[model samples]
Target chain A: MKHITDFTIVRREQLGQHYFALTLRHPGTLPSIAAGQFVEVEVMGTREVMLRRPISIHDVNPAENTLTLLIQVVGKGTRQLATLQEGDTLNLIYPLGHGFSVEGRNPLLVGGGAGIAPLLYLAKCYKAKGVETTILLGGRTKELIPVREAFEPYGKLLISTEDGSLGEKGMVTQHSLFSAAYDHICTCGPTPMMKAVGRYAVEKGVDCEVSLENMMACGIGACLCCVTDTDEGHKCVCKEGPVFDALKLKKWMGIE
Target chain B: MAKLETKIHNITLKNPVMTASGTFGYGEEFADFIDLTRLGGIIVKGTTGERRQGNAYPRMAETPSGMLNAVGLQNVGVENFCKQVYPRIKVIDTNILVNVSGSSIEEYCSVAEQINELPNIPGIELNISCPNVKKGGMGFGTNPEMAAQVVSEVRKVYGKTLIVKLTPNVTSIVDIAKAVEQAGADSVSLINTMLGMAIDVERQRPYLSTITGGLSGPCVKPVAVRMVWQVAHAVQIPVVGLGGISCANDALEFLMAGAKAIEVGTANFVDPTVTVKIVEGLQDYCQRHKIDDINDIIGII
Candidate 1:
């Protein structure tokens, strides 16, 4: 039982029609979070939703001890979470799951939909380490993409939209910059999109890692509910990884 | 403060908070967030003779104040559990109660027989409530005669305490409770997840991959208490209650309704340390009420 000391909604900014970025202050523990970790937020306004929604760590400023989450109002929980104002307290469990492992020198970051949250944190960490980083963000349309300016300071930015509304005006794979120009590729998004990126990286003989979005019960490994088959039989997405080397992912989970 | 302790049948629990089977894995998964030694017991996921991969995607969906899960009893076979998970979990301080599920009476008996040989294990909770499998989980439990047959066969080989977990997805829970009691069950746990389903109206498809699932959470607490009350009155054996117990107040409701002990299920997902809190809460409730012995409140309407 992790106790929540305080919850401060720092600010809320609408990213698109349905998505909003919530900047929160969780003084003591929020400062220590690494890239790719997430927090389970309990929605305060609604009586309809029961389970807490698991949101990715969009950005974190350890100096200020503040955390920001990029949330899409897909359902009742997120809608209620969106209603929270500054100084409003929430029940939050943070720094959950195995975060990313940045071992390589130059890394290629890929993100699609809500998966972009963790990629931004990854980009920041890599750039701070003096590693050359590139980020490719994908969404349904230009307006659906989030946090373009914040990521600019960290690395090269590439955008892809399904409706040809921004950047490459096509799928992320069609972008000219994604022609295996980087040393390693890291991706998070819809299973199909990530699998496509992973398959391309494998064929080009570049190392790749993918963050999975399996629906979880405990966010810990206890439920055996969020397991993905890998070369190692079965591994918990919350424990072994929410991030896995693309090469190790089994065929059924889609990476070749 | 002195720690609270409880006993169900011959098994001595350090506290009255145990993780309901199917919710908490073999106890090692929550080791980082909770102190397993502080808990009364941990019921492992349901296991059978052969490995089951369980249902497809979208096997879970959240409802108002609760959730539905149709995991279809996905488990590594009995051999793998004994070889892989058991060795590691045997080291934990809490009592480990293996939840046995099967497709046949023979399968149930075999699983119980193997577990009976394990040194540290205290008991077996027969999961007769799983609704997702094709054969024998909820199948035996829905029918009183079949439920008795399965319990009787498992009892023959099982020398330790046998707790038959009853399903509430039937007409009369009391009838099923009576059936298991007559079969020589040491105790019975009431109200496993209720049969339920959710729909994605936009897509016009069912929410769960199985089309239906077992519902559990705070929403089901009253119904579970009602069943526990009815079942306790129908049988002389101890009745352990579950289904939607998230706090000590909720657990105490079951105890007052005639349950000797309670299992915390879906609440584990809400808060991993819920069982420890529940035990402390129970002690606090007893202390405030000027009750010296915690068991004094059991079945005290």
Candidate 2:
């Protein structure tokens, strides 16, 4: 029932060997979307792929009516999504799932790899709301990072690469900027990385929230397929939250 | 407006579209999108005697037309569910079916017993098709004897409608359906996710953290419909068909295939408001065809 009216491929700039950023036209009246929210992009460019790919809303320009997506062609779906050109239409379910809650005045935005997409959006939103935002980005290399220029305007941007290719040649948490610089923390990325950030935030007595990437069939709560154990019980990432408070998440997800 | 009514088993659905368990998150989360009162019923997430943390990371992987998940029956246990979730959802107008999961017969009985005392719970759905867990889950449904045993034990303590959700991973769904029927199940729901796996060849590893996962979505539709047809012919109890049912036409396919009722599963993820849309679509289909009652089309084939 939810259909896309337009899918204008604004630009496609390759970030790494396989990763790219595909900025598209934002359709409909721009709803007040927050950081950590995602859009399900319909990638029907090829006969091989059918389902829509869930991509974090990397950045949005309400004035321009545009949304940017940082995609890594790790699979057939991404590869096909990458091949679409300008003026071509693609179906998209916009602003799905709950985004990061801007409860604290100062929150550390930690992200790695493709997970950085939502953090960038969060940083922009927080900055606009007059809240202090600090970001820590991590990847295998500097080339792996996407939309670095887009995040610079929001706040202080720190980077860590595994191969010492750029920024600080270490993990984002290992960087000196992570030493009790913020009152709270929010993160998204691989499970191990988020667990590390969550553990650090907990040890520091600061609240943290992590955006989870559980396998999802129906992004809604129906399938009961995406249940994640939490202090409250089984919670679906697509329904209850893709975002959870760090303390509550620690009790169930543990420290990886 | 117009009347939007449906019937499943002895229970009458305000509408034919009900949210599948695990997908709707105890039925409270979707209150923002659609009126839960308008729904036929809601199957809550799988509940057990003890808390479960579920499986490792990368619990989901997308396939060609569907996706796979190995979210091991992660739950807050029966006591917490009764204390926290049950109280809130009890006030909802729709019928609430608690999905009961356990690693053993005693566990199943224990949860069912607790659920029986709940305030507004109308039924209990035995999630015997969970492929992610090692102990109970699919282990119980794969074998006819084990499936029958669990059903029979839960039947003793659970006084409400008992619907045993059967797994599609088994070689013979009819045998298991028969076993649960004989074990005193009030009705049967099928087919749960099928066992499948996806590989990340470049990394030389599996896409899901659990390696193999349960598949669902449009890709599993034909297989699910076929199984529902086979089970309907073999069993005497009402059959609630589920699997990749996104639209009214898809639901009609199951009805014609002999499903007494159809449950919308993966479609909820594709569109949060899909249940409402499907209900309208079904009504429209019925009116156009001059079908007086929706139940008349059930098991038509």
lDDT of 1 by residue, A1-256 (tens): 3333456887888887878988887656544777887777776667797777778889888776788899888878888887877778877776777788875787889999888989888988898789868889998888778767888888888899989888888888888888776788888988888888988888788888888887777776666666777776566676677888888884744643
The worst-scoring run of ten residues by lDDT in candidate 2 chain A lies at A1-10
Model 2 agreement with the true structure over A77-96: per-residue lDDT tens digits: 78888787777776676566
Overall lDDT per candidate, in order of appearance: 0.84, 0.80
Candidate No. with top lDDT: 1
Instruction: Calculate DockQ per candidate and list them.
Output: 0.51, 0.37
Question: How many Å off is the CA of B62 in candidate 1?
Answer: 0.4
> What i-RMS does each candidate reach, in Å?
3.0, 4.8
lDDT by residue (B1-301, candidate 2, tens digit) is 2344655556766765676777677776666667777778888889999887788656877787788888787778899999988778899998898889988889999999999998688788899989989898899999999999899989889888899999999889999999999999988998889999999888899988789999988899999999999999998988888998988899889888987677887677666677878888888988898887777777888
In angstroms, the error of model 2 at A170 is: 6.3
What would the TM-scores of all predictions be?
0.94, 0.82
lDDT of 1 at A43: 63
DockQ computed for model 1 against the true two-chain complex using alpha carbons: 0.51
Model 1: per-residue Cα lDDT over B153-254, one tens digit each: 998999998999999999999999999989988899988999999999999999887899989999999899999988988899889989899999999998
Residue B300 deviation, candidate 2, in Å? 2.3
